[model samples]
Structure formats: structure tokens, C-alpha cells
Target: MTVRLDHRRVGLDRESLAAAYPSASASGRVVVVVFLHGLVETERSWFHRPRPGKARNGTDFGSRLAEDLAGTPVYVRYNTGRRICDNGRELADLLAELVEGWPVPITEIVLIGHSMGGLVARSAVRQAGDHPTPGLSKVTRLVCLGSPHTGAPLERGVVRVAGILGMFAALAPVARLMALRSDGIKDLARGSLHQDHRAEYGRPVDAGLPAGVRQLFVVATLSRSEGSLWGPLIGDLVVAPSSAGDRTQTADLEWLGGLHHFDLLSHDAVYGVVAEWLRT
Candidate 1:
């Protein structure tokens, strides 16, 4: 798994970083917007044009951020099979290296993650606090889109079904198959952010957001009205609104209706909200 800058492969080395962003060093101060994809997803997932015929090139969230916000977007591609905590630690180290090797001075860093990627971002922030990563100091904002901050009911249900199947000798193999899901997927069941805070198929630990960093938790619902009965029941057809973020009164949360979980990846409305937040 490698990190990409504007869709081009970029290594952590100074030379690679310089080559990747030829004009970055000349910029007075750079704002790096990092994009992390969800489970079983690659960096390209963020740039996917669902309606290619209607969408032009460079219209994705990252590209739009580059144009609308004048921020550099870096996409991360990692193995989703690993545990969230493990990936989080690795991401922290990677960001540290990126900052250290960057051609220009980093004024701020904004992390935008979708689904499990959001959990990875939160975990990385926690790991950075424990390890004192250089990049963590520059991170000004952390955004999670349709992340299961509480817990993902779908994953929980899967584990329950697997448990029931395991009780039957004839269905044991099927249960084992279900159990083969990656540790990353298992982490989603409880939205585990840290190793110590993890539970065995239980409620998610309420690990608070990092201090001083502007946090935004975006929830997407397939229903027309988030206040409707089906809104909370079928949130984006994957994560419920309650699971995506705390429903309490807070300025950090935003809700976008009539969108699915995957739609959060590249939807124009999603990008609009993110861009406005970053601008502020």
C-alpha cells in the first residue's frame, strides 16, 4: 500500500515528495488535505466517477478541493485486512514521514475519511498522541463521512449470524467463512478506535475526538427526511445516523439526506459541505 499525491505515486522520500509536488516548495504555506478510503477500498475509490458521462475529469472530492479550497490532496491506499489500530499506527507514521519529507512547509492538514477510513483517521489521531508524531501537530481538522462511530449494525448482525451458524455442525464451515472477515471489518462491528478500548462484539468505546482539532462527523441518509422513521432505521442503507455520529446538539455534525453510504465518497453535496467547512 502506497500514498498517492494527485493520483500519482509518491514515496516518503524527499526526492519523491519533491517530484510529486514540483511547485509545492514555492508555495508560501501549503494545506494538505488527506483522503482515506473505507474497508476493502483503494485510493481510487474517492476519485470514482459514478456517472462518468455527466461528470468531467477532476471533479472528484480531492480534485474539487484542490480547485475550490486551493489545498493539496493526498490519498492513502492501505490493506484493509489489518486491524484498525494497526493501520492507524501505520498511518500516523506515514503522515509523520510525509510531513518531514514534504517540499514545502505545512501550515495545516485536514483529514477526510469515509466509512471505516474515518475510524482509521480517529485511531491515527489517538496513536499520534501516544507516539508524538510531527504531522499530528499540524492537523487542524478531521472529517468523517458516514463513519460508524457508535457501531455498525450490519457487522454486528453478521457476527450474530455467524455465532448461530457455529452452533450447528453442518453450518460450522459457513460460520468459519463469515469469521474470515478481516480484523478491520471486525473492528467496524464496535467502531473500535484503540486496542485497549476494544470490546468483544460489544458497544463501541466512546473515545473522544482530539483536542483543538476541528471535528466534523457527516451522516448520510437514504431517506428524504432524516427525522422520518426510516431515516434512523436505514441510514444510507449501511450505517444508521445514530451510529455515524453523536446525535447530540453540536456544530460538528452535519446530515445530508437522500444519499447512500458510498455516495458520501464523491457526491457534490458532500463536497460542498466539506469545502465550506474547510474554508471556514
Candidate 2:
């Protein structure tokens, strides 16, 4: 019943991409921001909303971002099961169509990616810069929320565990199952995105960042005792601050305390900071 092998894609792929633009139905203000979800996530993940009255304890970061910008944000619903570079390549093509038939002239283009999505976004932007994508011309900003720009430490643990499991006959099946992670997940390895030259998943390379495109990284810490010994080890319980912040190379870093991985999605403080960035 579902179309496109993913979404209900009855129309042309280009048509689908064009239709996803926030400016398609809006007027004048043609600032479009594309929001990409993390691993194993889809467009629906962005629409996560809490109860009508519960704002503080809600789970709608995408919608909350729209409210902050006073505009709608475009959601990219792709197969997270695919390799990040593969998705990034497709995204580069899609963005061309997304803006080619813009009902209104696009004034600004922004990308906000979460986790693996951030890697994809980074890859796509690099490809766009090399290729001819209309969307790239107007790209002014890129914001990554809890994105492991360097690599995801948790994924390494999984790989190690998978390797260990394979050594036992009884756990071989479990190892195989765990090893079934998408190529995208495997690409989350250390320096995965730092390919000397882009090949596949090593995406919108921090090294290959387009000129004039402002980049912002936001990292969250869950430990109440950030200054303690295990603060870096327990950062958001997945990505370490050193990786998330990338402070040495990346100029802009925002560190927030008391938030986990998903918590970065809908945190009010984060929204406020992003909103201010958008305004400027």
C-alpha cells in the first residue's frame, strides 16, 4: 500500500522533493531550512509533539524550531538504512529539484542535521559545491545537534561486541544479527567523515566546508558532575564532548549540561540558542 518503497511517492521523485520545501506553500520569506534525522529515523521523527499543554516536557524539536523561526522547516524522509554517502549523493540531486521550481525565489538555505543526518548533510553540501545544485547557491548556514562529526564512540563498542560475539558458536547468530546494521551505521566509525577525498559516507566534510557557510556545533552533557573524572567518557552517554564539540578545529561550540542524546532534540535552551543564530 505504501509507495516509493519508503514513503507514498506517487509523484515523480523530483516532484516529491520540490513539494517538501517549506517555501512551496509559504510566501515572501523564502528562507528554507532542511531538517535531517539521525540513524534509523524518518521524517515522522521530526513531527514528534507532546501533549497540548506540556511544552517543557515535549518532544517536537522540528516543530519547535519552526515556531522559533516563525516558519516551517523542510523534513528529509529518506531510508536511513542506506549508506550515508549514498543518501548524501541522492540528497544532492534532490536539493537541485527542491529549489529548481521554487514558487518563490529562495533567499536563504540552511541545513540542520541530527546525529547521522548531520554527516549526510555535510556530505551533500560538499557534493553540491563540486556539482551544480541550485540549492547550494543560497546555503548560508549549517547547524548540527549532537552530531558526532568525528565519530560515534557507542558504535565502536557495538562493533567490538559484535566481534566478540562471533567468537562463540552460541552467540554467532546474535553477532550476525548485530552485524546487520546498515552501511550507514558502519560509517559512523572514527574519522569516517574525514576521508582524504570523499568516496561514500565520509560526508559534508568539515575540511571541505563550503565558503561563506557558517557552521555551528551543539554538544550536550548528561552527567550532573561535568567536571568529574568521567565527564568526557559519559557525554550524552553516546558521543563524547571532544567528538561532539570538535572544539580544536570547529570554531563555534555550544555546550549544554543535563541533556542526553534525544534531549538535544527538543530542549528549550537549545532552541533559544538556535533561534538567536537564525536571527543573526
Candidate achieving the largest lDDT: 1
Candidate 2 pairs with clashing backbones: 122-204, 123-203, 123-204
lDDT tens digits, residue span 121-204, model 1: 888887666687798878878999998887788998999999999999999999999988888888888888888756665465
- At residue 5, candidate 2 shows an lDDT of 15
Please give each candidate's TM-score. 0.92, 0.80
Find the candidate with the highest TM-score and give its number. 1
Question: In model 1, what is the error at residue 43, expressed in angstroms?
Answer: 0.5
Residue ranges of candidate 2 with Cα displaced over 4 Å = 1-29, 49-59, 62-67, 165-174, 194-205
TM-score of 2: 0.80
Q: Candidate 1 — what's its lDDT?
A: 0.82
For all candidates, the clash counts are 0, 3
User: Model-by-model lDDT, in order?
Assistant: 0.82, 0.70
